[model samples]
Target: MKPASKSPSLKCLFLVAALAVWPLPAALAQPQGESFSGYLQTVAAKARREGISETAITRTLSGLTPNQRVIELDSAQPGSQGGPPPMAPYIARHVGPSIVSRGRGRHAELSGVIRKVEARYGVPGPVLLAIWGHETNYGSYVGDFDLARSLATLAWEGRRRDLFEGELIALLKMVDRGVPSYKLKGSWAGAFGYPQFLPSVYLRLAVDGDGDGHADIFSSPSDTLASIANYFRDAGWRQGQPWGVRASVPSGFNVGAYSTRLTAPRCERVHERHSRWKSVSEWRALGVAPMAPIGGDVLASLFQPDGPGTPAYLLTGNYRVILQYNCSNYYALSVGLLADEIAR
Candidate 1:
């Protein structure tokens, strides 16, 4: 039985060849240029089976056409370019004085409602304001693309068909829930509302902040705050902990030695920049001192964003929560710093 055993190299080559010829699933086998008309019919059938109403489905999906602009925007996401720009410049621009000032003003303006949201959800008010400020400039704008059309276009584009198709279905459900179709406008990628939430997120987490019996995140600041806080809380934000702290590392400390071996299941690139988790006391023993107070027992990861001799931070679990909102080091850091500035 062992007479015809293959060499290891030959086996490896055979495996590679097999993988190269492996059959894709039927769903993926469909051509990228598959007719949008057929795709819509399939999606509409699925929606009907899922109990979405006829009026809702017709209102949103009937005669919907793919948006070329949405396709352009999705294809042009920042990650498609070369490696990300330097983090310091990114931080400078995003967390600059203007956002800080606006965030502080919004903090004061929304203090009472922010307090109520924080009391219920345990997320900090300034953090909420920072997110609001960053997402839509404190409700100055919330994009203008029709969400139904955008979702349908992205779905028909077939690059991320499953995701956009599901989102399209969720949009139909939102319509069924009495949300008017005309109000469904947002980013080219389909996030809408003051909090820039996708349809599924609005269904799951959006809350009525002012007890108006409607979670009108589009125009109501109170609903926006509550909805955002609910998102943070669901993402596991901890109370009474700073997202991170400015830290100073010792001379000749080998940050490379501390690079994490563990891989994240999602947002792997964003997670790669973080050093392995260590207790604050352990980092202190290694001469990594926090410029501000943090509990010695708290577990934190070192992030030398610009490398040694530059600004470093010891980030906590709350920082990870911020990353959950938007999976970028630059974005999370900006939000945390902006929040601190607003609170200060």
Candidate 2:
């Protein structure tokens, strides 16, 4: 047997040199490196040792160029000044008559699959429909980036290496398990299919609702709904409870005393919009009544998304479950409101 060749010591040295001499625009250039070729070969060898097939490796990596846009977007976190528009403005723009009309139409079209999903998962069909509407605008805009290429590029960039590396590996595993590369396209951030699931999420929660061998979220509404239901179930969705309801806040309601003293474990921004958890009875005593009736023994929290003076809400645990989807109060609230509308 041949002795193993000693690995090169200064792997990053050439990269550093390339960065120093290369102009900014040139650095953003397409694939152009014999040195990078060596690195990739070494990586391929390691992957092969770990049981990844040569064919899979070659196919997964063929024609991959470092995506400059991904690098730029990953580095540029949205600043406070340039952050998303306020809730009202954003709602006006995105949740208007046209969107609602289209959503209602889609809701009618997918009613059968939605009903089956809801029956199986105990989540309301309209609620799932509302989320589908909000996330991808009823499948009208599910992004257009190649999931593997984007994730691989982000993984190799070394800035958010840990995060994207995991996603890249998951993407490879997805291919290895038989998801066609052509069907693996999604958002620039690697969120894919009708429900915009991350690669890890797809592995864990994707379902073949139509009883086919594969979970085709890209094209199958049944699979998409089932996958979403599975996601919500995994995220602790409670059966037979309302997520939340809009309510009128009474006069002289003390906003100061209603604030949460502790931070939530996840989706802090969404939870921050809510007051500390209190029983529905306590809330009712404080002149907060649900605009819609809630049945059975449902534990609820009080929330005023636009502070105390505006409309308040009585939120159940299911509302927090919705937060797991997007981690935004506006998103959860909109889903709830839209579901109510659709149900009505």
Candidate 3:
């Protein structure tokens, strides 16, 4: 449930990625005639089958042109793109002092709202704030891409048409449900609001935290915080537990024996990087121990992002929940570490 942001966000923010706004084909551009128009018609018909009103479709989706930039970004994805660097360097950059400092400040400013959300959702304030800071820089830069256009363009490009088309239908549904076209601005890939819920995610989990009758994540910081917490709560964030803690893996430890055999459909590669589920006590018996606080007996898995020499982690189920938000080990680790610093 992450979105593309004006800036990079942590919650699967990197998981979702972003697009560009470059010029499309001279003739196929401008939401009008030719293949682009035909594609719109095809999607609009599908939307009709899905129960979107014709009027709403005509108003929001007619004459749409493909975005070349969205295509470029979508093509340049993680494995497709040159892939990211090692875990430690990426984590260090993502959870640096500036982000942590801003997160702490935002935490203080929204202390009242954080407390309220935690009271209602059983999610800690620091975790939510860290997500906020990572996604859209505490709402300072939630991208300016026209969501309809971005999703539409990605759909037309046809790389991952089924996925983008579904998102397009959801955005049209949002328009039908009275979300203004103007407010539908977000990441080039269709993540919106301070917390960056996709259109579908918004429909399922967005809440009215500000008591304003509207779950206005775009304008209401209160709602954004609550929505983020609610997302984690639904994603299985433990109420009174830390996400995970650093651990030391003994030299020459048999990593292959503990490797995960189960494969998750979503983020399969990310899940593949983790070790099999083992309780903290089991990990301790195997010569792995936490550097920070973690309860014994919790189900955890081993992860050594930088091979044998670098730091290792005994990631808990809550860490798995963080991955549900984005599904990247680096992203999940950064979020946990950032929340730690904010609380400090």
Top-lDDT structure, candidate number: 1
> After superposition, which runs of candidate 3 have C-alpha atoms over 4 Å from their true positions?
1-34, 80-84
RMSD of each: 13.1, 6.6, 8.5
Tens digit of lDDT per residue, candidate 2, span 51-146? 554455566665466678877777786654643444655545656776677767777888887778888988887777778788888777888888
Candidates sorted by lDDT, descending order? 1, 3, 2
Predicted candidate 3 versus true structure: per-residue lDDT over 1-344, tens digit per residue: 22211222353232222112232467444433436666776786687677776556765775455667776787777663565568878887889889989999888898998889999999999999888888888889998888888998887777677888888888887877778878989898989989888888988888999998888999898999889888999998887888888898888897778889898888887888889998888899989989987888788888887787888888888998888888777788898889999999
* Candidate 1 residue 293 C-alpha distance from true site, Å: 2.2
Candidate that beats the other on TM-score, 1 or 3, i.e. the better one: 1
Better of 1 and 2 by TM-score: 1
Against the correct fold, how does model 2 do in TM-score?
A: 0.83
Q: Runs in model 2 with CA error above 4 Å?
A: 1-25, 29-50, 80-85
Across residues 288-312, which tens digit of lDDT does each residue of candidate 1 receive? 9998878999999999888778889
- In model 2, the clashing pairs are none
Better of 2 and 3 by TM-score: 3
